[model samples]
Target: MNIRTAAVRILNSYHHQYFNYENKIAATSDGLKLSGKDRDFLYILVKGVILHRSYLDFVIEIAAQRSVKKFENTVLNLLRVGVFQYLILETPPHAFTNETVDAARQLKKPRAIGLINAVLRHLLLKDELKTRLAELPDNESLAIQFSHPQWMIDRWIEHFGIANTQIIADFNNSYQKIYFRHNPVKISWDDLSQILKDSGYTISVAIDSPILFFSTDTPGELIRSELFNKGFMSVQDISQSLAVRLLNPQPGEVIIDACAAPGGKTGMIAQLGGRESIVNAYDISPAKVQLLKNEAFRLGLDFVNYGVADARSGTFPMADKVLLDVPCSGTGVMARRADLRWNRTPQDLETLLVMQREILTNMVNAVKPGGVVIYSTCSIEPEENWQNIEWFLEANPDFTIESADNFVEAKWCDKNGAVQVLPHLHNETGGFAVRLQRR
Candidate 1:
């Protein structure tokens, strides 16, 4: 199949099976034996459609003069891909229209061929599309412009105000950089940097971290290289690494990663704390726990003990530090995970809050007296970050918020002393972490 057909199939899998777009893209790319350029084009088409879905749908409805809901899933996706090419990628009108129509025929959606051509032609004929989009009310306009859910835009406006909300939306729509955390246990920062530089990868360190580095060059080669497979480096965002930095695990301390899976933090803890520290990591999924175990082995961090257990309820060994990097709405990394904005709902936030609280409450008992429990999430929503910590503190008076200033730079922390990394402000993925100490 052609790259465009493969892009449509990946999108279909994401829509029908609710699978992650990244995973679906990877699997489809490999199955098709796509060349580098073909794979990149496929990625652009799928990711572009996902990132600008709302705007594309709006354009489709306007040009077709019918709601998008009436189109079959196949036809709808075909139109989205076509419109993305014409509008965002700015592929020439004739080229994109003809190619998209051909893709529909290739995918055996012959019925959509005429419709696709007609709508795309209609879109070309309409010079007032941009004007109409701009004329929408503020929230509606921002939602379509940024391809975010309107409710999400409303929530951000309520919490961060209109100006910051626009900034956040714009940031989320920008290109997300890939970051990798070097394993100090196996390689020093200088050695890794020199090696990567000698290999022609332009690498830069994160603002406050030496071990965390990012490259403007595509990470495909690095990720597939022996350096990553040998566990000299692991993919992790600087924002996510902040929680581990705040924990500051000591040589003899017992560290518990309550929701560790695909164990980046767990490995970091073991690396920072040395082999003497016992790191116990647990997650609800057995497959994920195995992934954590495999990662530990790859990193040569044999001291980490892995278990498959629910964090919301289960016995955990008492430890000097516990990291509860709970599941969240993932608002912070939307730029990286393009499909997340579409998959999440306000109700999902409500449900996640309850689950986050239960896990936090349960993990509190796992920390020894005077020990710390770092509550964190990759969400920018106030309700999921500080508000949850507030609720936890009010319910459990024995625990008190410790200023993150002692650990991270003051710039990343809010007035309340919690680490609040805003994507717009920090130019990093948004994340939150509060160090809570038990009295």
Candidate 2:
């Protein structure tokens, strides 16, 4: 199979249909029976194109001396893949141009073959592209250079200032390292580390946490490893682990994971809280609940109870702690979810805010008096983080803010005691979490 051609088809499908990019890529790779290296290269091409799409379009427009809107979707995506290879992957100019032209032909876009060749060849003259890009205004330049939406850039600059916003954008554009959290219930961290090393993979343990490990190795290899299949470790971000840590589940405590789907946090709570803890995990989707159940079984955490129910209005038994990892615009995890940056819009934020608010208001009812509710999101937006907490507190006078400093370092916590993990500063995915104790 032509990897570039496959990548073009995937990109075209992604542009039209809103599906998880990782799952889409995996399904396509499996169907094609792609070799290891071929699969890796295909991933790099498709994800790299999506990651730097705006910047590629910028160069394409400059090189072709025309707006990309005028081109057909197939031709535009063909050019995007070509420009991404030449500029970002640093593929040989001759091979990049010729192979991309061939991909267009294979996809039955013979008419676009000449145009793809011309635009890709023009990108070889890097100076001209850079000169033209430099002529744009600062905001437009930042948006194009970082491949983020202009509105998002503007919002970040207003909230975090230009320097920090640029740092966030740069972090999002770069590839992220794979982080794994060892399941102590199944294996010791020391044993897992030695096993991974003996298997010829270089692994590094996080300084602050022994259970956390990270590697630059290919994620597919790690995921398919025997240790992973046995549930010795889970692929989770260090930032994500913070919310569960802040929850600090105790043995015999009844914990409710209100929005538990993939069950990373649910598994962590089970591991940390021990078999004595009763974990009732719930999500709106039955498919997600099934996935959560599968993950729990893999980790040997049968103590966790799984159910399909929405956090917005689900009935639940009162618990010592409730974790509402609410959905949001997902602005924080743009790097890990490559297509998210393009899929999210300002209007989506307003819709998510209402749902987040509803979930927070309803879930707190399940928390017993003096118990804690940890509201969290994989988002950096203030509206989705501290602002929601502020709104909840005003409406529910019985709840009070509890500092996250007790669970994490002071640096990760804001003045109001919320944990705000920034990708640029923390070197992990950005996220937010706050502990609210019902008085």
Reference-based lDDT, each prediction: 0.87, 0.87
> Residue-wise lDDT of candidate 1 within 113-162, one digit each (tens)?
88888899998765678789778898889888889999999999998888
Best by TM-score: 2
- The deviation in Å at residue 3 for candidate 1 is 1.1
TM-scores, each model vs. reference: 0.94, 0.95
Give per-model CA RMSD: 1.9, 1.7
User: Per-residue lDDT for 1-439 in model 2, tens only?
Assistant: 6788999888888754367777778888999999878887888888899989999888989889999999888889889988888888898998988898888879999988878778877887899877877898888889999999999999999998888889999999888887777788988777877888888887776643534656636667888678789998888887888898899999999999999978899998999899899999999999999999999989999888888898899888999999999988888888888889888889999999999999987888899988999999999999998888888889999988888999888878878788999876787789999998998
Which stretch of 10 consecutive residues in model 2 shows the poorest summed lDDT?
207-216
What's the lDDT of the predicted structure labeled candidate 1? 0.87
TM-score of 2: 0.95
The residue pairs in collision within model 2 are none
